[model samples]
Target: MTESTTPGTASGIREFRMPDVGEGLTEAEILKWYVQPGDTVADGQVVCEVETAKAAVELPIPFDGTVHELRFPEGTTVDVGTVIITVATGAGGAPAESAAVREAAGSAGAVAAGDQAAPSAPAASDEEIEPEGRQPVLVGYGVSASSTKRRPRKPQAAPSVPGQPGAAEGGPRRPEAAAIQAEFNGHAAVVEGPTGVAGAAPAAVRPGGRPAGSAAPSVPGGRPLAKPPVRKLAKDLGIDLATVTPTGPDGIITREDVHAAASAVSVVPAPEAAALAEPVPAAAGPAREIRIPIKGVRKATAQAMVASAFTAPHVTEFITVDVTRTMKLVQELKQDPDMAGLRINPLLLVAKALLLAIRRNPEVNAAWDEANQEIVRKEYVNLGIAAATPRGLIVPNIKDAQAKTLPELASALGELVSTAREGKTSPAAMQGGTVTITNVGVFGVDTGTPILNPGESAILAFGAVKLQPWVHKGKVKPRQVTTLALSFDHRLVDGELGSKVLADIAAVLEQPKRLMTWS
Candidate 1:
């Protein structure tokens, strides 16, 4: 099976393989298909929506053509590099060979390893095939040529007759006849039934050949039925499927079931002891439970945070700052004609100050390359702004933020915020961040030790600004003050470097005019 464009045929048939939307993502579930067979599709038209582990991405067809066939149905999880659809480029009726190929590709039980099947092609000579068309390249993604050979399927077992001797009353016999015959003959056997018991009727027995009322032999439990995304959620939360109650249709374990089980277990005082004791009654538990599966952005964020927290040596430093001047400057910028129609807030200045600090202390903007045993210092800044969306926490960065002017930066920030709120941030917009700033101020929090984004060296947490009594120029007065906490990877940023970066940000925010001289 392979992607094909049959030669000498008027209609140029093309197979569209699933793309790796996120970096290193192996598979995605087809949430919906917009076009079906015989539907006319133009170049760059979205034909389907797929939900990967990272996010739900809309896939666009690369070339203009009429939809020849949809190889897979909606809700099917397809591996990256597997052909999902076919397009006919030329006009006229659908070819006969196309129908045959589509049938073979759509056959049940034809899936290979990783749940992917190659697209079936016409059995034509090599000379009949023409050069393939230009492959589609999605932004921030690389394309790879994948083999179309399908993996060999596992051999199916022969059906067993019930009530036969040496076989369970209702199930196939363990240590199958071949094993028992091999033991007796001292060699491998090809016999289908146990010796002298081919048609003999056995007594009433339960599974594992135990008497009807006797205890049955232990065996592995059946797995819970759930979608791939739900299964991933359970795995990330470290919840066992067997322990969860099924509430979905057809006795399937839904995402809500997994979350409810997790919540119930979380409130238990001692999990180990509770597990050893008898189960709690459903009526005795909470009246109503809302369980949400951690998936897409949320799951990725959790795994990345755990890895960053444990792998990188984090050293956080805090500083109380008088940002009265910066706050005043923000008010003035809001009215300035140059900054019109742009978001003008404390975060704008704070972000600028952080960028300036990074420029001053370049070493603080480096990443730890454990594979090469070196520190990779970045020349430009891809400043990450951590935005908390309904889906999860995402940090989409401003590309080359070091070069953007105040107005440009503000506009970018506005677009980033709006896009994040609308849940349209692309995977590329969230990658290659050098440093991150999480403004806890929006929630009116004082400050917190922020965790570093994976692959970045430092993170800055901006606290809420408040009026506090302070000595200003030998006088006691109310001053706008805030606390800033900076967490950095100690492997790349030393204590001195971290302190300098934080101090520089504080100094600029305090003076507001120092940005002119320092930067």
Candidate 2:
């Protein structure tokens, strides 16, 4: 992904939008920020690191100037093409003007003290105090003043008869739950007093009722404070904002607060009903479970696996092979002068054996084109080796493996494994593979019916090699043995073709001399 440059505005501000970091990815999470407001930056300077569905990548700024603002906070997943940061590109304004521009933009989204309506200012008129300044022209948020609408209050209950409770006090009729509508978000809620329990009575009464005091949270026209997104969320969940207590700064309701309120509404009873309900003990220690947000490679991998599993009909075949000779050959290759400085391991030979099988059975290396109703046979072999990393499982292939020499193939395989292990495998490296190999043997696993990588025709799972008693030449003998499971898209490779490919790999392993005659 590259920086998107916007034409300079009159404020000398240039908005830098998030680019499409992967193949048409819609969004990326800002993992960390390297610069803050007022920090000087240069062209091509790395400003932040972001994790898309594919991988984590560093984003560099294309403009050289003071970083006027960072639009989103760290860990925020922003949509592609949204302005992530803005810079003072220096055009039609003085340095002071630029500084003020930055300040206005920064403060516009900030929470302020006295964010609620002033006590002297009546709330019944749907009016709000605006910050005094030339409003910063943010893209999504409007500059118009914000206001809240108070729900109309219901009438108080008629005074009780002479013998009733209301009559005993010789006072006016007491207000019902709806009477608190004016002081909150118009919901007939069990109003809580300053002590944070339900009040003895409703706070805001209509005409001919108790006068509201400092204890009354909001006046007749005021509504609960929340951002537009939070308001939308509350509306979607059918929750009244006033009934939801705000925990954010300056009495603003946040998404978490709204969600918590929704959950409470569903599970917990109202205070009046719960008064007669049995009490339960509160939790006494740290939470029992932890939550990890899935993003980047893991998310993409999960989606791909699901799609592959359901879309492609897979057939797996297993074979047990005696690889005592192949093990010796691996040691011999490590000592070969031509293989010096190259990584030598059983995986290297296994990869070569699979490449040979694909050459012998080319139809197994083909893809089913459902849309075109045809089979696409590939000529070149992009042999994929599945490597597990801290981020996730990524299979980066050695391109054109069928043409590579023994030492060259060893070098490519080594580089691929090391790069994936270090979490440096690029998106391009993981794309367009025709076949794959998963070395489950590294973990001492016997075998697994491996799932095909999305878009790839087949995958091979190599199991643990260990000394086991076997009938060698009709006599009991100890030999190196391993199991191999090959899973292929049945739509492309039939039973005969799939079996032949798997058998060729086993044959190459069993007869080490085939390396001289096969090619």
Per-model TM against the reference: 0.63, 0.73
User: Which residue ranges in model 1 land beyond 4 Å of their true spot?
Assistant: 1-14, 36-38, 53-56, 65-77, 87-292
- Cα lDDT tens digits for candidate 2, 37-141: 778889999999987776678889987888866766565677888877877777443222332233332332432212223234443445334456544443333
Candidate 2's C-alpha runs over 4 A off are 1-10, 91-129, 132-247, 250-289
The clash count for each model shown is 0, 0
> What is the TM-score of candidate 2?
0.73
Native-to-model Cα distance after best TM-score fit, residue 255 in candidate 1, in Å: 14
Output the number of the lDDT-best candidate: 2
**Residues 281-303, candidate 1, lDDT per residue (tens digit)?**
44456635345555567778899
Ten consecutive residues with minimal summed lDDT in candidate 2? 110-119
The predictions' CA RMSDs to the true structure, in order, are 11.4, 7.9
